[model samples]
Target chain A: MDNTESIYEKSVVPNTMGTKSFNIDNLFLVAFFGGVIPMVVLGAKNAKWLNISKKLIYMLIIFGAALLVTKLVFVAMITSGSLDLDNTTLNISYRVGSVLLFIAFKLVLNKAFHQHMVVCGKMEALLKPALIWIVVGIVVEFVLVVAVSM
Target chain B: MCEEQYANDRKMIEHYFSMDRYEDARPIIENLLLSDPQDPETLYLMGVVYLSREQYTEARELVQEALRNGYNPEYAFFFIGLTYQEQKMYAEAEDAYLRSLEINPNQANVNAAYGYLMLLTGHDEKAIKLLDEAIRIDPDDSAVNDYVYRFYLAKNDGSNQAQYLQRTMEIARNEQEKLINIAVYHLVKEDTKTAEEYLRQLYLLDPTNKHVLEVLEEINRTNHMLFLPNRLIDKIGGPAVFYIGFIILVLVLTWADINSIAIVILALYLITAGYTWLAPLLYRLFVKGKI
Candidate 1:
């Protein structure tokens, strides 16, 4: 091959498909308001956009389920007088739990999130989807908490 | 000419262009164009020469002609973007950059250029994402590093600014760039005496650099002691710091069962947060008259 042809080959990359995903900052905002459920749901959606492995998506769901179960168990214990915790301590524990879930969301999807931003350079707005998910998550969380308490 | 001879001539032209000896390459480029006026590669290289000479109209026409003749469309579009940007035709520049990016989103230079355009147009959030992507794609690109450093500097994000400034310093290609980075490094480190020394050297090298003069003036105007509070807040008092601090305060109050003392501490924390948010703005207004 000629030098010019070789240089062209080196410089030109094959065109790949680009897909838009929700911004990580918006996902963080969802997590702050609606906690683990909506965070995992939105993260899974982003994983789909990024074409992340299905196995990683399953792992994320499982991680979120485990955190929810632990929260439910903690609530049940508190309601049954088995673990006597004051209001201040309970508030702190809830904050810590939310933070842990948020960290997990970040760890599981950080690479894909950055890759999406780099490749797409634009993100789908999260407002409508985030609202729907957060409302659904809140209702389900409320029901589970009430059931656990009973 | 034989094919091999033509290849050798093209190689020689490329060598001259790479070394920034556009004048030396011009005669050969003219000959190649004279022999085969429709050759896309020759047309593109001639476009680059025009671009270097600030002949934007000729550069754009040649690049577009190359694109029509099936040259690398992504690179042609990127070159078109650069010409438009130099001419301050921002909307056309953005369109050209988007076209280039649409063809190959992985291009680091296109991403950085688009990010800079976004920054100029006041779309800061989008600029941050695009610039971050460019850095991820090519961390060694000094131009992109400089843009990110300047972005962080404008936001008063001292940690990020320091990080990119160091990267720019490490990859500085020329003496002027190296001198500027070193001076800014010392300035950010609050070593005004050392920074002034380097800035003076830079001033002697390039008397037309207004940034050097402005920084020197600012250094002369402000007392370092009075600026300490503002600098410290900018350096270590971002939102994440305050949020973590508040979390720790809550944990401490709960664990220690110090309700009465907690009120005083919380009030003090609020005051600190307020000061952290306001100190830089107040300093700019009072000291620099910038805002």
Candidate 2:
């Protein structure tokens, strides 16, 4: 059917009972904006360790923390492997994980944060290490999404 | 005086269009048309806005006015063709498409539309050839794939249908494909469980997948009776892990109910704290300092 016809059908007979339609393109767009772009922006602007060059420190802190947390969750889930897909337990776990990933993404855009601060005259010194944190955040999110889905 | 007023009118028309306030654009465009009744650009633009809103009759009149005024008549033809298609006037659509193609044969949309019109007219072979030509010009043309998919599906030739469906999936280029392909593959293999699992994932990813909606309804109605046999969860190591954890939790709860509850609550708290606080502290202590 044409997109117009499909749209008409959807509007005329709205699927009121079920979840909303998910377009992969839409999902990817959401991820790019909500997860990726913000992370990149934040990573570029943020400073680490009261200096601009210590970005690596920020990267390690976020990634190490996220990785360790994900590992623990994986172990728990593996150990208690249950068939209760009905429970919101997995959903909660994933949402929390995704949010962590989001924060990591923000770290990647750390320079953007630092730059904003600098522009605002809050920080006189620019730390370059924050850039590494941004890269780490982006990589972490990319890996986690692929790993979890797989 | 005339030149300046007309320029201002055009500017005002563009401003309203930019703001996406089409209702506001109408009076300005109409006034422009009244002042300079011979202006093709204003007529064409008015047609375009109306066409976007699916106001076919008004769009047609405005477009024809542009054509009559000797403006870019090919675009007028194209929009008229699209409006005809919207109205399901396939014969008129085909003629208008042909007219537009005659004017601008190189335009991908014209070829794609002509191809789609042919498909709707049951000229499958011609439609396919035209669509292929369009694809060669613009490989990502949506209308061409949509029409071709429709044609093959109607033909009910399994292999051909699958082939076109695969094309559509590729063109779709979304995460939805991840769920869709897995579900369909399992369904074809008669592995209902795996199919159902993928379907569930598909629903979670995008609840709007019509095929998934249908399968979910069928499964629910049958009370999950029609199951695909192949086990994907095992291959992925998800099912086993989930089952083991669930069984252990159940056993612990059954024996020392109160103690298990307390332990569960404590464990939850510890896990949350570790993820949010302790883990970050350890990272800052060791990895952050080192790296």
Candidate 3:
């Protein structure tokens, strides 16, 4: 069938509803943009299907603290005039380190939290918004990286 | 009892493999191999596990071993084709898939695989034919239908793209694929209005679908479609032209006594605006020609 005919069919096609569609790709995309945090909070807020344990939160806190310390050290080094790295190099390293830290924190926390999941149902709806944000975030990040590197 | 145990082990392997627990399935395959290392079926299953993990080299080796050890050569060849496909060795994949097809002419997957390879190599006609055959072999198989639909989409078979995309959605297993396809269906149909709707629906379904978002962005940015400018001109052009012409007419009427001076002034205004601005505006208004 041609697109035009199909479009016509779409208009006339009767409603027989039951199935729900969830966008998995979008869920992944949103994760990149801090969309994952809110999404995970909502998904776990009920604690029915998946539980977010205190240990996972502690791990995240530790990761955040470590990241803060790293930044402080870098700043101290720059202020003390001890480190002799070029501005571009230092900035790139800082940016990349921040990204890596976040990735590591996420991976570790995800492993901790998702591993003990109770099989409740699909998580697509929860994840979709986050995924879109993630894609947008990645694109922006990529553009920034290219600009910065250049 | 031992035979039953062997069968149960194979079943367990199959179950784990299906669930994508390849690591869990590996031990079972190893146990089966312990009993009879030459077990063709076990070897084939092992090969499939590797294939699923995208371990192409090991998959090819194991599948070839399965064939040598007298497994279902049809499936073994098909798996070999799959491994080759993963490695992007299209010619080898084609040869392996064809060999499988020769053994089992009605095998849907072999035909589908071959059809996909044809698409990769730009053999559109052959790809469609093979995919059609796959669909013929398994009419109720949504995946095969999806392949056929996507094949048409790749060929840019305008109407067919819509039809198959719709069909693919109808039998689509997930809401996400269904939503994405609906937008795609409208998109291929040149029904941008509907396409954007579905694309938005797709975003609501799974917001991270960059492809859907990108397509939506593309559609949103492309407002100056060929018919749009003409329609816009039809709506406002008459009044605009009349008003502008009236001013010019008045200028000529009042300045006919100083015709040479009036003509020069008009020419100056036209030249100043025409090449630098009006021509570009008109070009944008009419064809939306872009660099």
DockQ, all candidates in order: 0.04, 0.01, 0.01
TM-score of the second chain in candidate 3:
0.58
Per-residue lDDT tens digits for candidate 3, residues B1-291, read: 287898888788878765446878988898888878998888888887787677999989997988998888888888887887777666667677767877777887677767766655545566667777788788767668777776665455567776887788788767767776776556655577898887787788666556677777667655444335433433553222322453466466555787677667667545543343243365566654553
Root-mean-square deviation (CA) per prediction: 12.0, 23.2, 23.5
lDDT of 1 by residue, A28-127 (tens): 5576578777888888888776666799788878878887887788889989999887646665565556555666666666655554443334678898
Query: What's the TM-score of each model vs. the native?
Result: 0.44, 0.35, 0.42
Q: Per-residue alpha-carbon lDDT of model 2 for B1-291, expressed as tens digits?
A: 388887897888788775445767888887887777778898898887897677898888888888899878678888888887776666666667667867766667677777666544435566666666676777675446655555554344467657766776777646565466657545544466688898998888766556578887655533321121112223433222333344456456756766767577557644543343244344446644642
Local distance difference test, each candidate: 0.73, 0.55, 0.58
Q: Summing lDDT over every window of 10 consecutive residues in candidate 3 chain A, give the lowest-scoring window.
A: A4-13
Of the true interface contacts, what fraction does each candidate have?
0.00, 0.00, 0.00
Between candidates 2 and 3, the TM-score winner: 3
Say which prediction, candidate 1 or candidate 3, comes out ahead on TM-score. 1
Q: Return the lDDT, model 2, position B95.
A: 66
Q: Output the better candidate (1/2) by TM-score.
A: 1
Which 10 consecutive positions of candidate 1 chain B have the poorest summed lDDT?
B234-243
Candidate 1 Cα deviation (angstroms), residue A86: 5.1
Q: Write candidate 1's Cα lDDT for B45-88 as tens digits.
A: 99999998889989999999999999999999999988987776
Ranking by DockQ: 1, 2, 3
